[model samples]
Target: MTRVLITGATGQVGRELVEVFADLEVTALDRAHLDVTHRDDVLDVVRRLRPHVVVNAAAWTDVDGCESDPERAHRVNAESVRWLTEATREVGGHLCHISTDYVFDGTARRPYREDDATNPRSVYGRSKLAGELELDPSATLVRTSWVFGRYGSNVVGTVLRLLDAGAPLRFVDDQVGCPTEAYDLALTIRGLVDARHAGPVHVTNDEPMSWFGFVQRVAAAAGGDPEQVEPIQTADLVPPRPAPRPPYSVLDGSLLHSLDTTAPGDLDRAIERVVAAMRSTVKR
Candidate 1:
């Protein structure tokens, strides 16, 4: 039996990974159990467990927060990843790290390929890119975008809450990317682990859409009035966010598709599943 150690076990991706890889000798660790930012702690845990794989799902995901505290972000995203990779390599274990689509500058007219030039516009992106570069050949770097799921706070959850509160929502139409479901992403990760596929792979839902279009779909799926969801440019909405967002960061899923490892759900079906799951949680 393969022993797998998962970091950020309480997170959306980590939770889904735990559920998907239940058959494996899985030791799920949150920050309480293992702090990746602490090199000694990470090294100690890996040496103690001696697992076959280390899947790192823990990340400082607050994009705006990263802009304000780049140093902390680097510690959490880049330095921690390097530590984990080195630890895993020392133990002859594979490291599976999750990354974001923000690595791209979003200037591409079409979807971003895996080998495309990475020009990160924000601190979060740069940190994630650095993390990716630190991984060894045994590691798998999975890049996704607009991720949401049932485990924790996400864009879908936030939108639903706003709609339930009868608040007018204005989403930026200028920004575009694939809205990925964490469940699908988790399954894809499991597939890659099982197959021992290495290198950077882009994993996301099949379709891409603007934030306004995505919000509209979410509202419609959640039984909200779509007309109430307004469209605006990124410049129109001024939130006190610290980072600048990519105008377009849609990732090309062709690479994963060629390997027959692409996600099953598209944007429409993904939204439906998310809405159903959220509604079930509310009823409970």
Candidate 2:
């Protein structure tokens, strides 16, 4: 069995990774156990384990919080990645790090490609880009957008919660991107890790739509009326968001095909599964 070391194992993606890699020899660790920002500690852990692959799923993902604390964001997102790169090198292991579509400044009319020029507009995006720069082409860099999953706080869960409570749904129509199911993404990551794929790659669900449409889809999947979702512009936000999200973040998933792979099945099917699973837990 392939030995895999996963950081941020408690996160949405991290949790799904653990579940998907159940057959493998996996060592999953959370921030409390392994503070990746500490260089010596990260090096010590990797050097000791010497796993075949080290999946760095840990990240400071609070976009607005990153804007307020740029230094902390760089430390966790960029500096920690440098440490992980060095550690993985010491063990002669493949490093699979997760990245965001936020690296691209939402200005492209066409889908963003792997080689597209990146101009991140917010502190969080800039920090993530810095981390991406730390890796050589030998490492696998997966850039995804609008990621959601069953294990953590995500837009999917948020929508379900609001719908269950009979709350209003207001979403921005201007910002568009792909929604990635974490379980499927984890499966792709496993494939990449097994193949020891190198270079930057984009992975996301099939459909590309705006946030408003996405919320409506979620509401519909949860047995709520899609029309109940209020469409609003980004500028109409009462208290403006701290970080500026990309207006268009649909990635060119064609890169996955080049790697002899493809995105998982239909996005609507995935959404329905998530909705069913979430609803099952609701108290009658």
Over the stretch 11-90, how does candidate 2's per-residue lDDT look in tens digits?
Answer: 98999989878898999999998999999989989988888899999999999999999999999999999999999988
Candidate models: Cα lDDT each: 0.90, 0.90
Expressed as tens digits, the lDDT of each residue in 1-284 for candidate 1 is: 99999999999899999998899999999999999999999999999999999999999999988998999999999999989998999999989999999999989998999899999999999999999999987688899999889879998888999998998898989899988899999999998887777999999986889989989999999999888889998888776356878889999988898885545467678789988998899989
Candidate 2 has a TM-score of 0.97
Model 2 RMSD vs true structure:
1.1
In model 2, the runs with Cα more than 4 Å from the true position are none
